[model samples]
Target chain A: MRRLRHYARLLAVQMRTSLTLAVQYRFDFFLEGALALFWLAITLIPLLVVYSRRESVAGWSFPEALVVVGWFSVLKSVLDGGVTPSLNFVVEGVRKGTLDFVLLKPADAQFLVSTARFEPWRILDFLGSIAVLVYAFHRLGHAPRAGDLMVGLALFGVALILLYSLWILVVSVSFRVVKVDNLSYLFISIFDAGRWPIDVFKGALRLIFTVVFPLALMTTYPAQALLGKLTSAHALLAGTGGLAFAAIARFVWKRALRAYTSASS
Target chain B: MIRARKLCKTYRVHRRPPGLLEALRSVVRRRYEEVRALCDVSFDIAPGERVGFLGPNGAGKTTALKILSGLLYPTSGSVTVGDFVPQDRRTEFLHMITLVMGQKQQLLWDLPPAETFAMNRALFDLPRDEADATQKELVDLLEIGPLIGKPTRQLSLGERMKCELVAALLHRPRVLFLDEPTIGLDVSMQARVRDFIRRYNESTGATVLLTSHYMEDVAALCPRVIVIDKGHLVYDGDLRTLARRIRPEKRITMHFSSLPAPGELDRLGNCVARSELQATLAVPAAQVTEAVRAALGRLPISDISVEDPPLEEIMQEFLGGQPANGGVRSA
Candidate 1:
């Protein structure tokens, strides 16, 4: 608990610093928020056109698909706004040998890297995404069961942990492949597949998405929880995937650090 | 306290020459080479001791420092810093040490240095009051009162460097690993930084292990130095001993009011250079005083001073210009 509090303080201070920096470029901050709204509209329009042709695709109604889309936006914004910035700090630090400074600090190295940078504007997108998520539920004309709501929130946490573990593995690999700085872009591209429900894919592709990449675990299953379509068995499977990825991240991180011969002057 | 026993760090690096063909080929078939950064490096540093790790670039000075600071795990060997295994990077170990690399700025680039300091204070888990007091003391000592408020990107290199020191020290670390902390600073700024480091070490009793290419940095700050060449420890002892052992000639330079006859000064010492206003002679260490007295009696000299050959020359001789795979002495 003491360790937890220490990290909380550390993250708070870092976010405060990021906030101050964001304020200095207020125009850019608002501009990006506007762009996020624009992106949401642009994304929904194409899907709206597709829904006009078919009553349902992959067993998801248009409004139900909207929930998945809204969840996608929320996760993407959160990762882009908070985690990606900090992930960049880790990658850049390793490439430039600035990670040495981080290692010397009294805090946990992973904690330091993950909390070093925050994008205040990204929070704007997160808020916007949450609004869309609420609107989608409202359009469906059904309130979620209390139990389903609780499970949805729990799965949300698990999804976030799983994705963060994947991110850690990416950055950990970057310590060795210093020249590959665009791994984040690669991650974002892969994440694009998660916008659609895994049910849309078939055969080998569905298995790959659900189990290997786990894009379905990031958004679809949680959205299913709210729609009352989720099962305890599936939730357990997602939770297990999260735990497995968490372990993999830890192992990869240790191995990568051991392999790290910090960049020469 | 710091200790290293036969510390070795080896890296498996991808090798490729610069060319479109090589780049294209590397995409499919890249070659890996084993580069030994440090070989059997060992050293012990007591509390409050300031030691310089001296070598040319790629001589493993940084690799050693990185291992000591726990940023990298050695391929072999062991190191304990403040009684904590550095490679373990336990919170207690990190709390007791700070590494400042001049080439890299840890401060949030777009934010004010004050923010970084505040974050560091929290990360180090200092009480709010104690953190504030430490920040005030360090900012005042570095005389960077105004710079902390401005964005770090706007600050000049020297200003940023001074600010960097404040960020690194908010934790009041007992051990400091400084890698080229004065790199790229002007002569005066370098001197100021060197002075600040000395004072910090004296006041806090922080054990400092520093590496720099600048000879003045070592001469002014570290009385002892460990010289490495191609992953080998060349010399590890008093700075004066290394200098004297590598290059024994003491330089005696005299400034004369008028041109002295050229041959008249040669008898006193071997004339390294002679000019109308000044003349430099390389005299044996045992005969520096005698040479100076002889020059004073022979010519109406305005000023006469005796000093060791500049450290750059000594290193040049010691490393043989390019560091080679060779033997070394340890004390």
Candidate 2:
């Protein structure tokens, strides 16, 4: 518990510093906001076109699909806002030997690396996603029950854990591989597949996302919970998958740290 | 309170030639070469002792320091610092020690140094007043009071390094591992850092293990020195003793009132350098007095001084004489 408090305090420091840094570069924030909105529009344009042609695809209605896309947007915003910047820190830390300083600290290395930065401007995407979610709810003309809201929040938390775990797993490869310029691109490409419903994928590809890659848990399961379509077993499965991915991430991080010879020597 | 028995750290590095075909081939069949970073290195540091870890580049000095500070795990060995194994990196152990690398910094680059200090205060769970007091003391010592407010990237390297010291030392750890702490600093800045480190050690009674390519830093701060070359320990003990052991000749330099004949100076000792009216001779420690007298009597000497050979030369000779695989000294 004390360790948790220490990590929390360190994370708070990171958040505060990142906020100040973002504020200093206000122009960059505006640029990032514009970019994020443009990307969101690009993602939604196809959905709008598809819905115009067909009422629904893969059992999900057009408005319901908007909720899925919005929820994904929110999750992606959180990730781009926090984990992306932190991964950059990891990459630079590895290159410059600053990770040695982190390893020397008394705190857990994983916590330090994960919560080391935040990009406040990326929250624009979250706001945009919330706006879409509200509009989609109004168009559907249905209010989620109290139980559904609770399940949605819980599933959202699970999705966050899964996303964070996958990111750490990807970035931790920097310990063994010095050059990680393309690693994040590869990760985002895999994640882009999650923008659609997992059911749309079939056979080995579906199995890959569902069981092996696990991007399905990051988007589809959470959106399913929020739309009141997730069964108790599915919720349990998502939670279990989150826990397993987190454990694997921790294991991989430990192994990577052990393998870290540092850049100086 | 630091001890290591046969501590060894080796790294397996992937090797590939620089070519498109080699890059493709490496993707298919990657080859690795094992480099011994630290081989059977063993040393004991008593509480409050400040020892200079000395070596040429890639001499295992930084490697040993990294292992002792828990930054890297040793491949095989028994190592303990203040009753905790370093590789375990226990909280108490980490809290008790600090490592400062001049090439790398712990400060948040985009934030002010004061922010990092505050962050460390919370991370270390230091009492507010105590942490503040330590910070103030270090800030005053480093004379970085005003510089702390500026973003780290905006500060000069020396200023940033001073702030880095404050961040690392705010917890008042009992053990400090400093690698090239004075590197890239101006002469005066280096001297200031050396003085600050000495004063900190004196005040806190902290044990310091320092590695630096700058011999002046070692000469100023450390009484005992450990010399390593190519992952092996070649010499260990008193700095003066090591210098005398390796380079027994004292350098005698004289400024003559008039030009002296070459053979006249050669009679005094082995002429190391000679100019129109000045000459320098390398005389064995036992013969330094006789050599000086002979030069004074035979030559029109206006001024003369005798001193031990430069530390750099002593180190070069020490490293050059070491046998291959003369692995790190074991206690």
Deviation from native of the Cα of residue A16 in model 2, angstroms: 0.8
For residue B156, give model 1's deviation from the true position in Å: 2.0
Candidate 2 residues lying further than 4 Å off, grouped into runs, are A1-4, B18-20, B321-331
* Estimated TM-score for each candidate: 0.94, 0.95
lDDT of 2 at B95: 94
Q: Top TM-score: which candidate number?
A: 2
The C-alpha interface RMSD of every prediction is 1.4, 1.6
Cα lDDT of model 1 by residue, B175-281, tens digit: 99998898888888988999999999999889988987677888889999998878888788999988888878899988988888767887887888876798899
Lowest lDDT sum, 10 consecutive residues, model 1 chain B, at B322-331
- List ranges where model 1 is wrong by over 4 Å: B323-331
lDDT of 2 by residue, B1-331 (tens): 9998888889898899999999999999999999998888788889999999887777788889888887788999878999998878888998999999888888888878988898889778898999999899899988888999988999998998899899999999999999888777888899899999999999889999988768888888999998777777667789999888888889999998888865787778888888888888899999987887777778899999998887776776777854311222211
